[model samples]
Target: MRTFVAGQEAVDETEFVELALGIDVDLFRGPLEKETAEERRARRDVAREVLRELRESAEAGDEVAGWDALYADALMRTVPFVRAARGQRAGTGVAA
Candidate 1:
């Protein structure tokens, strides 16, 4: 949860570059890139709708469902695209 700014003793060039570019170097451990302005607005709208549904479900005493598995599956389906994007971004000669 802690971030090191440029020029910090513990920070290195790769970390600085990642910070500047808004990309994560440690893909397995770092946070995803922040959403764009349009994405933020769209997500806010979706969140409002989800919240309304949750409130309605709560009032009806219905169980609130978690979409963890669905989201995991969706992510799994997008793995190839993600890998391609990462490879393109990194300029690595790997084919996806």
Candidate 2:
């Protein structure tokens, strides 16, 4: 049996597997195609850990003069995404 995947773009692992495995396309679905609930949870957990460290470092006050602002901005951006991830399954866009 012959299989064809059409595109001028570079084929990634997912497309390669699809062609090789006889097109069980779902064999490779992750942060690229769809973000699963487990993936979301893991991402959120890592964010939480990073935030914790950021808070600690900010309290320490030994970094540059603008790191606090960056941390705050990251927190603000992360909040909404984390909240969205908390909702139903993420069959959505690239991010949350």
Candidate 3:
């Protein structure tokens, strides 16, 4: 681990060593578990449903009124999983 301090502030060697040791301890922690199959399926289903609704609305011209009707719909559907994955990645320092 690298320690960075403002130019005006100086850290002693012992403090720097402690900081590096802490970082090393954290780095060796186990990776996070992947999402379960059920969770993946559920999220996919939600995204599919949202896409279907968007398609229907577009077909019916309901989306023609400058409506952001489907705005972020797909993203919203996957937000939970995305957030979980992000948390896992950040915590474990591993890609999900």
* Top candidate (lDDT): 2
Best by TM-score: 2
Residue 23 miss distance in model 3 (angstroms): 41
Clashes per prediction?
Answer: 0, 0, 0
Query: What are the lDDT scores of the predictions, listed in order?
Result: 0.44, 0.46, 0.43
Tens-place lDDT digits, model 1, residues 32-85: 454444774565455445545655655676543233223322333342445455
Instruction: Give me the runs in candidate 1 sitting further than 4 Å from their true place.
Output: 1-31, 65-96
TM-score of each candidate structure, all chains considered together: 0.33, 0.37, 0.34
Query: In candidate 1, how many Å is residue 58 off?
Result: 0.7
Model 3 per-residue lDDT tens digits across residues 6-60: 3223266645643443221111222134565576567556655655665677778
